[model samples]
Target: MASVVLTACQEEEGAEEGETPEVSVVVSLAIFDDFARQLGGDRVDVPTLVPGGADPHTYEPGPSRVAELTKADLVIMNGLGLEAGLEDVIEENTPSSTPIVELAEGLPVIDGNPHLWLDVQNAIAYVEHIHDALVEIDPAGAEAYRANTDRYLAELQALDEEVAAAIDSIPSERRKLVTFHDAFPYLALRYGLEVVSVVVASPGKEPSAKDVANLVDAIVEEDVPAVFKEPQLNARILELAADDAGVEVCTLYSGTLDKKVDTYVKLMRFNAKELARCLG
Candidate 1:
């Protein structure tokens, strides 16, 4: 939720055709960092503020990270509240002339949820935004950025289709989600799955006894075969709830990445397969 407070940086046209511009970029999360890399290729240096396997909802940026931000040619974050921990620090330290772009700024938001990229279509939109931001800062590399963006967009379309097929494999009655946090609404909406229960509304919030009770009840009532716990967020509460409900717990990638899945595309494929295995 940071405003681009500084004056716009001067436009430059230096890189020749077929060569990539070397732009320093600081991204707030790993997923967005991957998106920038997919679009920028070898030209952009995307240093993620939040580390992999860490929950961005509760993550705080440190001094070393601030130093990176200060020198970054472009600063990018997922707006809507994903960078809640880094917003103030970035705004305070970034140069007035550099552009700080929020990848999710212009996309459709659902109930103010910051996990818009969970939907493949929304992720495509984010890549488009990244392309525009890259071009604006490096007009010389516009062709390169556009080519990279188009290629990644096509791959994203294939990913969307693949996810749809995987989800469709599950029986309609079992297409439901019980997750650690309210982070799967967009994904659920995309695949026609319902978010039956969640341990907490957002990261860092403690769940009440009633919340646990309701979650277990919903699991039983909905008859979902398995509940999901994100790799990055603590899921003890969710595990206990699932145990109480007598259903097995499975893994899902939400706000962050881990060893098994390091990139956004891998994360989506992992989710689709896990969902099918756990629910089909």
Candidate 2:
């Protein structure tokens, strides 16, 4: 729980003259990495450990990556047990003096879910936390950071309205969601949709027969038109579940973004459009 204040760059202490020393930040998630990059602008260097379209829940970095992380001034994580596999490596490799900011900390937790960024308001909160951390680490850049945060927050607010309108287009009874895993509870909650069932309790783990059976039953009973599959995960299980329920399987960007859903705002709009098409 170290604050970002511990990440004051050493380069700032001995800079000759007029050189703006960049703060190096190691972010565990791609989305947050992009956020830091956008907000940090020229003042920060963000190297993401998890690559684009990689599953954070099961991603494990090699020794080289670990060494890179050890040298970072700050490490940012989504927290809430999302990066379960990388926890030990992140804990052991990061330098003692470095600070780690968990963006989802202090936010509302529902049913122990960690996908807060799926909710636009929570994503705004993330932007605020990241802005505060960046300003704390480099107090000289506070004004720039505040300005960047304001611009991004405005974009997020507009995207939130877009998501609401898209979801509203779907009939109340049709606004049920079934996904490859429990990835979209926050999205559903925010958009007035219900997550009827998930094909797997956790990604990368095989679903038991009971789990599949229960999900199939729910899908059939709820008349869920489509089951969503994530881009980073294998769609075999979801396809099977959808086939069993006599429904179609659509793609959703749970965590990592692909070429189609590149930025955070684009990711939200893309998912909203898909949900509208499938459920409306």
Candidate 3:
């Protein structure tokens, strides 16, 4: 959902400042890490503090994570409220000199939703922020970063068009979305789907029996063809609701990723594919 960046740097143990030392960029989510990798190329191998298949909303890094945070040369995060937990820890423990860049900060939001990257345009914005940050932190790699970002940004623009066309293939009436959580509002807005309801309004809040029943009722009433669940969250709640409503449960990539969906473009492509298959 969000991330914080930290950097660990030295002149390669024996090298001097003029040498091109590999950047140690640390970000909070797998998505941001991928962006850094794409832009940084061989110059950086960024580590994602929150591993894949973990929900950033409720994840709390362990004690040893502080060492990494302290040593980071640049730390990037999706500010706003996505990584509030990590933000608190960074404030208390990380050194004041640790350079911090938030990818989602200052971007437009819908009702303050932090999942802005769900929209391809917003994802592009995050990539742009990352591109700028990398250029700032490692002036030596500015040309590489610029070139990589140009190619990556162009690919994302094409992806945006592809996703739009995919969504447009679904019948208008079947475009309603009932997701496992509130992560899809931005995605829904972008692709013309309406978020009819969510099983859990927030992460870590399991739906009670009554809540599930209510969601089932809403699903039945909405008559959406399918309900979606994120890969990293519990699908049982959505499965139960969908079963009772006689609808299919499909997968959507949201806050986190798995081995199969290891990159941002793949994540978005997976989402559009699942949506079209289930609802088209």
Candidate 4:
């Protein structure tokens, strides 16, 4: 009878060992979640803290999201002050045993601009980071992660070359960028362009009359041709300021993904195409 009981217990343990627990990933934004999905393949499930079209700088995760973070196997974040509002929640909810990966690790980060994925090279670095983190979390999926990262890295290299060609079409003198926020420094740096001035210093902060006036003077001084507004933010103020400064207003994606440019590759291409159209 004792032998029979031991045999039944061993059978139950064998069944449990064969079961695969679902791997959970909590990403700070949609783009990172998308990247995670690409690398994780079908082996992992990712939940985004910031919804599509939501600004990462000001996004606040709700109770449901907090619970998701607590149970996640891995937590991915942009990690350059982009998710300022949800940092507390991410820290508090995530278990110490769970691995937290900052996708922007090893990328050249600017002091104030957290939009690292705007530059294709930075995005490539992010993919590498994601790949390594996923492999560490699920060693069984290491080969898949490496293969996916290599494929994605090739695409990013192609994108880098495409963006370079697009920016090369613009005259060096016409390569000035004026935006609603100081978000595109990495993009400008990567493409050999210049950021003349930004309307606001921080996210969600509106430009004052005096601030607008100062930007107008700088724009006139720099002879900037276009002012770029982020698609996720209200552009009325930027439009009015651009009119005052005698510059055209164009749209750029900052922290959020838009419907048209849903993927990271598409987002960079869209920005390049728009910049070429406006500045070329």
Candidate 5:
């Protein structure tokens, strides 16, 4: 009976030793968390700083979030001035040795539009970066990360084609996007659309009366039919402005995802579909 109990205990210890350790990751936003999930699979445990539909621009990471960042083995951020509020927290909390992956690091980033994930091609590049960083942090899951990234990249490629075709259907003249901020320049430049006007240059900054008047004039001059607003932005002013200008108000996702359009691929597809419906 003593031998039998010892053997069972040994077997249990062996089983525990064979199980993989969970990799702790802290992502700036839910979108990065989604990418981490796709690449990390069961090997990683990711906690996001910004919740769903939360704007990374204006998000203030609390002490609890900073503590979480300090404990993470890997920290992934959108970069490009998107995480304005968490910059100091990331710098202070995250150790120098911790692998910090900026999804927009290698891409040709625009000044104001940190919504790089909105463009499918850009998202492919981000996935590659995320995959490499994950493999570096946890070599044991390298094969898994590579396989998952390959599959996810294929899906993103298909999404790219779909977005291209959808945008092609919209007439060039009708492709002008007027929005709350210059957040869609990458998307517009990628798909041959043009941004006509911006209510504000930076996130959380309301346009002055002069600026709004100028935008109103530009919208009238360009015959822009719609003014796009993100879910997190103050749409009341935009609605009143659009109403005053006789244009439609449409909502677009920037830096964050809605529950229905969660993944990067789905978000891009949704943007294209919405643009087609509103602008085309």
Candidate 6:
């Protein structure tokens, strides 16, 4: 509800009194919300369901949020189990005519991680699908959506190369990554980094003592340089694993974004740099 109110400011200051309102969109997470805004520009009302710095894995939408979803012209979701907490609400509330598009539909699914956008390649796919959906929903804005998609894809392509090169700079022996959860499989597969082990399988899930023990064994055996913690998840378990393994602990951003790194481009750049710092 707070997120809906925050993004509902579109009606406050603009235009003639009789202009047609933009198509309203409700996105399940912050990243998709940014994607809608960037591609739709002023032609779409994109209200992010999960607020910034929140975990989509555990975010529960309230009644007001369900109402917004019911009235939205489109509901965009990652659809790879990223928003497990909202499944019932989305199924029960979204109108039948409202088109619900899943950005991760055709992408390669990692075993347990649904963070496909972490890979710029997968993000390009997301942009293409979003462009198609936007064009289908708002034919009048087709030209604008195409232009924005082209420009954004170019930027993503450049970011892809930059991430590849930056990750390549790290020696092969140091390319192993250990993080709080299994959120980096796509990233590690896209880059050359190997996921040594993850402390937890998913966000908001606690690891068992046996799981932690096994992770510590892997970390110590692999001599992992660091165990990364995500901003949206509690880092205490990662801290325990790192301490047991005698390695450094660092931070990584996964499902959440802030003012400092709000967009997908900035978020990827920040993550690449942080990984390089930790592993290179």
What local distance difference test score does each model get? 0.88, 0.86, 0.85, 0.86, 0.84, 0.86
In TM-score terms, candidate 2 sits at 0.91
Candidate 1 structure quality by residue, lDDT tens digits, 1-280: 1233332222222333235437988999899889999888878888889999888988997788888988888998889887788889889988998899987787778899989999999999888888888998888779888999999999999999999999999999999899998999999999889988888988888999999999999999989899999888778988998888899999989989877799999999999999999999
Q: What's the lDDT of the predicted structure labeled candidate 3?
A: 0.85
* Cα lDDT, model 1, residue 127: 89
Best by lDDT: 1
| Tens-digit lDDT track of model 6 for 1-280 | 9888766665553443236557898999888888888898878888788888888889998788788987888889988788899888888988999898988998779774689998899999998998999888889789989998898889999999999998998889889988887888889999988998888777777789898899899998987888788888888877988888788888878888888889888889998898889888
Candidate 5's C-alpha runs over 4 A off are 1-21
Write candidate 5's Cα lDDT for 1-280 as tens digits. Answer: 9999999999986676536647888999888888999988878888899888877888887778788887899999988888899888888889888988778877887764687777778888888998888888888678889999999889888889999899999888899998887788888888999888888877888678888788888888999979899877777767777888999999887777877878766778788888999988
User: Per-residue lDDT of 165-274 in model 4, one digit per residue for the tens?
Assistant: 99999999999998988888999999999988888876778678898888888888998878899887877877887898777888888777867878888888888988
Model 5, poorest ten-residue lDDT window? 13-22
TM-score of each: 0.92, 0.91, 0.90, 0.90, 0.91, 0.91
Q: lDDT score, residue 21, model 5? A: 49
Model 2: per-residue Cα lDDT over 1-280, one tens digit each: 2444444444454463346547888888889987998798877878788888889999997777777787787889999999998899989988898888999999999888889999999999999999988888788789889898898899899999999999999999899998887889899989999988887767778888888888889999999988889899998867887888799888789789777778888888989999999988
Q: Global lDDT for candidate 4? A: 0.86
- True lDDT of residue 236, candidate 5: 75
Clashing pairs in 2: none
